[model samples]
Target: MPTTARVVVLEGDFGVCAIQELELPDPGPHQAVLEIYAAGIEHGQLQQVEEPQPLPVIPGREGTARVLEVGSEVTRCKVDDVVLITPWSADPGREPELPLVEFDDGTETEVAPAGSWGTNLILDEQFVVPIPNLMDKEGASVLGNTTLFAASAVRTAGVGEGDSAAVFGCAGVGLSTIAAAAAAGAGTIIAVARDDERLEAATASGATETLNLSSAAAVERIAELVPGGVDHLFDCVYEFETASRPGRTPVRDGGSALVVGLPGTEERQDDLDA
Candidate 1:
């Protein structure tokens, strides 16, 4: 049976979006149907719709929902279980192979539209992670992707007990990196941002120190504080020429520099050499 679903659709590359009714298929043997509670409209989704791409696609990547129906073979979750819907899985290295959608016009698309801004969703059991019963639905929805990226960056940097780390950008990912570093037992955590207000928020989120990137002596100051430099440097902004260059120096010689943000088209070996 097909269920009536209300979904937000991206109509074109000019940022046009619309709400329309569609028929969602019932869950398969390894799938589950969920009543979506919250979905985050992230910047990446916005960029997707704004940039050139196939039109009439759904745009969203993270959300939370309550399971309403489970397929016969599904054992990971049951009815009424609140779960986080994310594009990511336990394995970060591999991409998910989602089933394709066949439109009524005989056109087929291979992308997974499960995260579409819809009232309900039919997703594979593997993409939905069960959350604690008491967890806030909205928070769990938005935290899934950003938290995974931040946590992975921290782990890749080898932050451990008594280690020190510095996070740049102070955006969602940067702030999360700071908190993750603190939780990982980093002895010192430095948050860097161009804005004063974001720096304050980073401090509240467990940053032992905050640096205003706008300051002319910001890099020098960071070097002075950490002496030889921190154990890890997380570049969340990825402004390689300006930010990552100076940012790299604050990392101890053997420490890793993790770039979390997207880089520009221009290639520069000098940036990586830092």
Candidate 2:
């Protein structure tokens, strides 16, 4: 008999999930069994639901977990240590070995690389990162995903002191990008959103100016504010027509416009500008 874990399983329909009991897998020589404390839902996982992938899928990509069991060769953490669970493997060059979810009757569903959204998960030692227990589990989980994404975008774009930056969409990740830019000494930061509430949130996150997409011409407004154009444009919203086109308009020639968000629907190659 193995330990039972509750997993969120998505069967035929898209965006629908059901709770089911599954038998936890034993840790492999280089793996650890983790008891997840807090999990964050990533947009990539949600996007997968609509695309063609195996059904009865488990959809969490990042989380905070407590190590419960380790294999003979595992040296990452002890039984009670807390760790961060990332979808990407510790070794990027190799394909990840995913654990199967076993049902009561001994039937098993083979899940690919992504870990389950469940109470217990068996993962490779490299996927579990030991962290200081100072921050709450919820906040730590967020830091691994959304905040990490924002930081990566800012650093990759080489946004420096006194550079004009604009963020299109003030959701969680968007707000995080705004804060990161301000912390890096950005000169003028413009936050664009479809509503006032998001704009207000962006302001609180250190945005110097806010624009409501529905109320005015976003590209023109941003150009007026930035003069020549913005140095960096980060788009985190996914509209059907403007997956990220509108935000790209404000970037100066040769400037970077990073699409940090996931698209709701895929567009044909012909529809996009070169």
Candidate 3:
């Protein structure tokens, strides 16, 4: 059975998008049809526009939605269930009926991952997280991508119970990392950022402590608090300008520092050399 879905399309480069309607066809046996409530924009959405790709991409990567329908054999959710949509598709091996959407102009073409429209799209159950019905839709939407990235980083860093960890940046990924670390039962979670608002967000996200880098020697302050240094450090601001900073050095001798973030390369060599 086919259903109507609304989507925001970016006909060309830039983040600007236009809303349109599409006819969604029957979902795969393991898929569910999602009616989006809210979607969050990610950095990759903007960056991808510059790379070569087909035009008219659906721009949302993650979002909050309600299950309008489910295909046979789908057990994770049922109609009317609130959920979060993540870009990770657990089963991409199966040939999708998608790219199945027909544009309003009566044209049809393939849509890439960028076309993983949360506004209204058929999604795999594995990519959907069942959320509390009472949870704020906007917050749940933003958390999808953040949690996805944070979870992987935390897992890769091997954070453990009672371990001390510090996260720098305190924005989307940073805040989410703090939350993920806390969820992993980290003993002390330190959040370092330049803004008060972000630091506050980090605390709410589960940071046991917070620091504003502009006010003090962040590394020194962190070392003083953790004594032997934190067990792990997530340097979210690992860019050219801040690359050589001691932000990543506050880890203990055997501890790990996970450096992340996009950066310009021209000055990276010179800065790291200093």
Cα lDDT tens digits, model 1, 1-274, are 6666677777756888887666667777777888889987766666667888776676777888999988887777999999888766654454544534544445565547456478977777777888987998887777766777788888888889988887877888888899899999998888888899999999988899998877777777778879998888887776634543544456788988887756533553346554
Runs in model 1 deviating more than 4 A are 91-106, 110-114, 240-248, 264-274
Question: Which digits, one per residue and each the tens of the lDDT, describe model 2 over residues 141-255?
Answer: 7656677678778988888999999887888889989999998889999998888998999999999999888754766788889878899988777562443356446578888
CA RMSD of each candidate after superposition: 2.8, 3.1, 3.2
All candidates in order of lDDT, best leading: 2, 1, 3
User: Candidate 1, which ten residues in sequence have the lowest lDDT sum?
Assistant: 96-105
Rank by TM-score, highest first.
1, 3, 2
- For all candidates, what are the clash counts? 0, 0, 0
lDDT tens string, model 3, 194-255? 89999999989999998887865766788889998889988676552363354445678888
Give the per-residue Cα lDDT of candidate 2 at 31: 72
- Superposed Cα RMSD, model 1: 2.8
lDDT of 3: 0.75
Alpha-carbon lDDT, every model = 0.76, 0.76, 0.75
Q: Give the top-scoring candidate (lDDT).
A: 2
Roughly what TM-score does model 2 have, to 2 decimal places? 0.83
Superposed Cα deviation of residue 207, candidate 3 (Å): 2.2
